[model samples]
Target: MANDFDTIKKNANSFIIEIHKFIRENFQVSIGDQKKYLDSVTKDSVKTGQAKLGSFIISVSDVLLDSMIIIVYTFLFLIYKEHFKLFLAKLIKKENHPALMDILSQIKVSINNYIVSLIIEMIVVAVLTSLGLWIIGIKYFILLGLITGILNLIPYIGITIAGIITVLASLTGSGEISVILGILIVNIIVQFIDNNLLVPLIINSKVEINAFVSIMGIIVGGAAAGISGMFLAIPLLAILKIIFDRIESLEPWGYLMGNHVPRKFAWRVRRTKTQE
Candidate 1:
């Protein structure tokens, strides 16, 4: 746990430092570009700069405000969680109340275990990534590794962003396209190992939620709640499945939420039936 925490802290520091470095480098480059653009433009330079600044401020504020609201809501929900459970119980029929409580308990347990497993997996990924990048003598390996590990939390989208950022950082640091390709190869190898070995042993065994369901949940979540929704979706679906599986009428929906067999296996079964 201490080691995990250290890795997170170290990675975070690296991430921030690399961001600062990138910004500094770009700012230096953009200075000449901006001068050329402003000189070429007919509009008043000061006014244009002010307008751009205003727009940037507004966009940043909107993001910050939304994030703060989410944090506050989450805090309040945690504080009143027990009361919320009681509130839920009161809404249901007395006969169904026990079953509801049972379902909720299962949901809580499943989510908790899944979260723990994810954290462990992330720690392992971060450590290995940092080590690998360090071995290859990448300048911002810590930052890239940290970003890669953290982004893996979001289904489908996160790793792609990680790859782009890491590759760009490599390009900036080394000025070599070969380094970028190397990073891609390392990323693919790490991702392959993670998906096949680490995920099955850690996340898949515990979550039992298939990739299709998880991806759909992530998309739906993003549509409904933006980034937070994507983070919340899988757990929400997992909880829904627990409830659906428990209720007599909802068994079919629970199965729908469950993992599907491999396509090859399904095809084989279908062929056997056709032969029969």
Candidate 2:
């Protein structure tokens, strides 16, 4: 038990160190010249990015949540086999049992297709993240690459929240307090990289919505679809905003839903100073 604990702790420390390096690298991406680069990325690129990011996050979160639900319900299936088995049994009893086989075959094909799509999306994320980590000179670049790519699939605050959760989990399992500190420091640095650099360039450039709208979408989505909704809502809204932006009649609505390219810097500065 002691050895296992020690091993977990060591792994946790390594994980934290890697995470920090990833963050530092992510932040190094150019957010574009405040004056010019914004004009370069098209509205379509923003819409596509938003959709891709949203779909990835929602799908990952859904799978995780579904796994949790399955675990919770597993014991019930065992104890209440008669009640649970009835559904499958009834299907088996159908006159055209061959149809059942066809249905099962279709289900299998669908599952395989879905899994393949997920793998492809994950690959894209990993490549993008790994490139960033490599540039940042983070160790265990592959691991950070996978994590950031997967985590980004979650909408708005999902990636940030996931990083925090991962750091906290690592800290709790770590044997040395230094491991915890290491993880926290690394995450902060990574987030700085993401927020100040990578995200501003990738996410903000694509989704032209303001902070307030994003927050509001998260709240409403969370209420409706729970966490899954929150993750999906932002991208969905961004798509709507994009279409709205193109039409004169709907431009005002889009403006309300979307964000201004350059928010009031002075107001943000004052708000930050006040918080400080």
Candidate 3:
């Protein structure tokens, strides 16, 4: 019995030692592998961050340069406005000068009206947005509303970005799903009213552009010159429409771009009657 007990004690001690030995061997290898992985990840993250920073700096520099150029050109144009008119007059016949001047005046008035209407729309949108956010108990509602108003100038994508920003801001505070939902609902309702009512009454009335042309212009402008292009698209299209309408050969194109919708079969019946 003594001999059997001794053998059992020796076997149990050996089993424990073997388990400890196995753990010790594997633990060192696991720790070394984990350290290597962490080091690699840290190095990669630093490289990626540096690349992003460099790209961001370059973009900001380009934007600043563009802004400075635009400011300089605006100042020059304001200072030499009559000189530009004279140059345009010189490009055409003397008899056509009056017509050309009339076109220029029309263009100036249209652009002014469009800009003023946009400002009014912005103010309206800002007030509505602030009121909505305030009602939802959102933090920094005024600032967010102002941002939404500014972004709203960018056309279709602007409102979407505003919604995302508002949702994110709400998340930072309460982080509640209900707050996020409330923010979204408010934005949607405001956007709906702005699009259906305010835009038609204010912007569309001034610009006289069809929805299809406006959307296409924004898309093409965005693809060509980014955000600035999108913002300028409507005014530019309006200007083009004015020019096209003045030119006899291009009147059809001006009509095509305009918001005027005729009866479905009116044109066809008119053509048949003319033939008869």
Candidate 4:
């Protein structure tokens, strides 16, 4: 019995050592690409100058203002859909991008797997938010659930704006602080699921963007076209990377955008016969 116990201990130690060694090797391999990503971001740091923290604060304020304005316009369009449709038709006609449209369509199909996954995730978010709202005794819980589910289509900003509007609407109707708090709590829970789980799964489907480039894209796009631009920037960058990968002229740009250079060989993981 003592001999058996000693052998077991020795095997466990070997197992642990092998696992650690494998992990260390993988870490060293990934570190090369990590350094390249860092270098790329550092090079772009100069261009991101002047637009700092204060700029983000200002951007937040502008986003809030724009969301509220959108709410107003939404109500207006509800009353006059035909007029809004005419205006939108004129706008799209004036700014046509057939090439861009074709590219985006192809890219969307390429990422269809990720898109379907996102829809499943939004369904989960809807269920949770709806349950929470119902528990909190919100009268329009179903309506709020639908809105929240739709807003989940937009990352980050849309969720917050939708939550705020729902809470404010609740306040206006019920005039109860507890109701507002309940709404806030439910929204927080939904956002927690979104940020921690759904986002990591969906966003990480592609190569991860560096943190600094993401912020810079938000800043630059927001400055150029407000809320729409901020929401569009990340996907636009990803799409650009996809296009660059296809076009030889743009291969360098694709390399610059990506976190990792494509490696031709798959590194094999081997286990000792004793482990097998």
The most accurate candidate by lDDT is 3
Q: Which regions of candidate 1 fall more than 4 Å away from where they truly are?
A: 1-70, 155-157, 164-173, 194-201, 260-276
Candidate closest to the true structure, highest TM-score: 3
Please give the distance, in angstroms, between residue 152's alpha carbon in candidate 3 and its true position after superposition: 1.8
lDDT of each: 0.74, 0.58, 0.79, 0.66
Instruction: Give the higher-lDDT candidate: 2 or 4.
Output: 4
Q: Candidate 4 on 93-147: residue-level lDDT in tens?
A: 5444454456556666545554565577778788888889889887667777877
Which candidate order results from sorting by lDDT in descending order? 3, 1, 4, 2
lDDT of 3 by residue, 129-166 (tens): 99999998987799889989977876666687788777
Candidate 4 CA-lDDT value: 0.66
lDDT of 1 by residue, 1-276 (tens): 233455545555565456555655877645455546657773656787889889867755654454566578779988999998989888999998888878888978998988898898888787778777777777678887888898776555667878877755554444444565677788888888788888767865576777678778879887887666766777788888898899889998888777867789999999999999
Off by over 4 Å in 2: 1-6, 9-63, 66-141, 155-174, 261-276
TM-score of 3: 0.67
**Window of ten residues with lowest summed lDDT in model 4:** 264-273
By summed lDDT, which 10 consecutive residues of candidate 3 come out lowest?
1-10
Better of 2 and 4 by TM-score: 4
Model 2 per-residue lDDT tens digits across residues 146-256: 776576655545556545544444433443445446544555565566556554445544565566786777799878876567655656676567556655788899888
Candidate achieving higher TM-score, 1 or 4: 1
